[model samples]
Target chain A: MFKNFFPNKILSLSNNLLNSLLVYLILVMFLGLIYSLYISPPDYIQGDSVRIMYVHVPSSFISLACFGIIGIASILNLVFKIKFIPLMSKSLAPVGCTFTLISIVTGSLWGKPTWGTWWAWDARLTSMVILLLFYFGYIFVWKFVSSFNKANKISSIIAIIGLLNLPVIKYSVDWWNTLHQPSSITLTSAPTIHYSMLIPLIIMLAGMIIYLLIIFLMKYKTETIKFKMNKIKNKK
Target chain B: MLGKNAKKRAILLTLLLLLSAVTIFLIFKSLEENIVYFFTPSEIYNKQNISFNKTIRVGGLVKENSISKEQNSVKFIITDFKNEIIVSYSGLIPNLFSEGKGVIAEGELKDKKYFIAEKILAKHDENYMPPEVTKALEKSNK
Candidate 1:
């Protein structure tokens, strides 16, 4: 019954959604900037430097989320023989790596002021480094392996294995004595932050997520087109 | 074509899994000991054969009215409400360093009770305390 839904229409829908989301993304980001800079009160302790969380936290969240997507998409590709899922996973790698890089850089800037140092071999920080290495390793697998099936299988395994790091990263502070603070927000409890600060953080998170979606869709579309073009060339 | 390639792929998959398992095990094993950077005053107090000069981190709440500023150094006591140790630091303190706040000081102990902190990290915000500090506080409270 649902088979009538055509791929062309789905692509067109995503394109339209992407255009509108791009606009919304900019608008939300600007609002987030205003809130982060002006509306939210300086932290009771760290003061203005705490503003970095608006960028740092959202980027960290998105980067970790990207890994989760890559892991899931890889599984679906391997099991269900989905063609686009591998490309989607591949497209996510660079974006995830970029966000992780941003988070690390901003985290350093934030840490230097508050933690009295720019870097530490703290559990949370170390696990994040490992996550970045996994991203690089996944991308390298795709590049090095010439056989398409082999590349997909190996990269998918890498992505799945890398999933072990995500839980460790999230729980590192709780499980180990590290310089990183425990999370202020948790799933079961209300946020520890004030409503004013939390509001801007939410807005920033929303903006970052929409931006990631736009990039993901764009990458997927480009890869699909390239795949089709290569197919035509092979026919010729 | 897939069936022809299955044997090689199976071998590759098994090897990759074994490689990752060993790598992860090594990482966790190496990280296990160094993971706990800070020890509470109670924990430090209860320990025997303590090295008097090895650098360590002591995390706890700053005892109220314990802060005294000198020309170049500041002295205070960190307490877990069960045990306390005096910390002396000759440097610029973090912005959040204040009495009645959570802090972690890294330095060697002059003896068992006096800590000379080379670096001090105060709590980042009202809502955030280093997880170790919270855990130490919880354990000591019990």
Candidate 2:
């Protein structure tokens, strides 16, 4: 029982945590480069230009995943009505926004080489732009509303409703044929990606997911601590 | 005062959360299975296909001596250094697309090597050069 409470237990575990995490980061980066450049066989068709999937697909996954967190945090706040819940949701906004921003920025970068144009009004692209706007509105709601309870009130509504755009983004291509190409790998269909390419992609995405988790945990811990400290100070 | 504020806030927050959860669940359920990637011609020949399954991209160079406006389709010779491929695009080619420029058309693969292009991607221009080219040039000089 005493051992469970010891500082050594927690301290020692966390000591090498940073080092092991560093190794994981380097390993993922190396694998990502290797898979895209070497391991992955070129598309029998698109050839090397197909390598953008390594970056684009994973970033899009992260974008979707980040917003999922917002939905969960919002639900927890409602059920528990915990003060901490809203505070955590508030802290999550910037991170989710950052992921969404990366998705759009990289998509634009990849567009120049592939699509031959910097921008398009294509349905998928347009819905994504709307998603970006929703993110801005979500952040704005939190920033402008001074009262914590009131801010939580408004932000929760926006986050839930904003989700309407996610489906629009997905179906935009199927709903209407546009410049954006149709999805290649499907749930029932075999993946069109070659193994050499697929392995590295999976590795890179795993690294990104882990990296996001580490940051989210760190952020949550810091926020919780600050909240506690503020509470104590008020009492004093 | 505190009790009223807390209760009212809780009620509003609950309704919003329930609606949002259902909506987000719908989004997750709707995630697409297939993903697409784009490519350039030279990269296709040199690297092979980069996607997982059957790869797709436009293949051709501007067909020399063949390019002319026949109604909507512009005919051209898409050539590598060795062999030439023929292409017909009905829609507008970007201003950058012209004779002598390398291009890769995207669409279905017809027969053995023929590509029936649905979209045209006109290749490089004076304003653009692959970063790899400069790096490779520098490395060679070194």
Candidate 3:
């Protein structure tokens, strides 16, 4: 079962899948952008500024999702002692970091027009900043550690620790009196947002997921190639 | 078969993770009061000891038809429905500030029913809809 997760297997499969993924990504992102920017109606209360949700919400969601993937992969690597698992998490870190940064920046831009302040020390906002710091710590561990096995061990520990922050970030708004409002869409209940707005949001979210897949595959490919090169050099 | 060393490492790692999680939970639990961004009108009223001079935030809905504007100053009532606070401020309110909308006032408490706000921020709810939908909803409500 785990043999399918091997680096060589995944690398070969990803090479073939990458082109189709790119085509779908471009098409989805194009449609997503048009729908979010024009086709969707402007918010009644927020007016045009509400359009920022198209980018901000999706970015935040992707960032959280990327971290989740890293955390789970780290756990599996630790338990099963899989050599290639660390590579997957390592490739995912930069993508997660980039999305976290995007979420914070877009959120700040949205905050100014909507929340009447550029930043607040509210629970929801503070937890997100903490998440970005965790991402930074995880990436830095891989960069600074000289030995591959040592780096993998240390980074896995960091990711597992960082996993603790995920729930705090998700429930921060509900658990505290936050300037940020509670989530409008939840899996357990009907979304409060109108379909006209929700449709574009879903499209944008899909586009973002595809975009993440593309970036992850590219990074994973590069890392695998480097691993192969290093292995050949070691044998020689 | 899994090595005994790997089994020991796994157990140790699990302990470490659990210990840290408990520590974090305790820390957050201790800091609960400090973590709240603002107090509701009722919360302020319920508090036994609240400093009059210390600046704090009070958040709630702006009561309907309670706004009064004058040169360089404005007055409105902030209510959580159960309790209400009369807020007085002299500042440029945010664009979303209006009657019967969510708002937060950060300032000093003058008394039980009065507050002197230094800055006012508008708080929008989670609901999002187009202008036409909002208009239709308003009409239906009326």
| Candidate that would win on DockQ | 3
Q: Residue A108 of candidate 2: its Cα lDDT? A: 74
Ranking by TM-score: 3, 1, 2
> What TM-scores result for chain A when each predicted structure is judged separately against the true chain A?
0.92, 0.83, 0.95
* Docking quality tier of model 3: medium
Which clashing pairs does model 3 show?
none
Arranged by DockQ with the best first, the candidates are 3, 1, 2
In angstroms and one decimal each, the interface RMSD of every candidate reads 6.5, 10.9, 1.4
Residues A4-123 of candidate 1: C-alpha lDDT, one tens digit per residue? 122343345455577898899999999999999898877656768889988999999999999988987775666566676787798788889899999999999998888878888788
All models: lDDT? 0.82, 0.62, 0.90
Per-residue lDDT of model 2, residues B12-99, tens digit only: 7667657876766566457422221233344444544344234365444565665777877776766665555455567857644666
lDDT of 3 by residue, A1-236 (tens): 34534687766764557889889989998999899999999999999999999999999998998999999888778977878889989999998999999999999999888878888888999999999999999999989997888989889988998999999999998988989989999989999899999998999999889888778878877888888888898899
Where is the poorest 10-residue window by lDDT in model 1 chain A?
A1-10
Candidate 3 chain B has its poorest 10 consecutive residues by lDDT at B1-10
Native-vs-model 1 lDDT? 0.82
Off by over 4 Å in 2: A1-19, B1-142
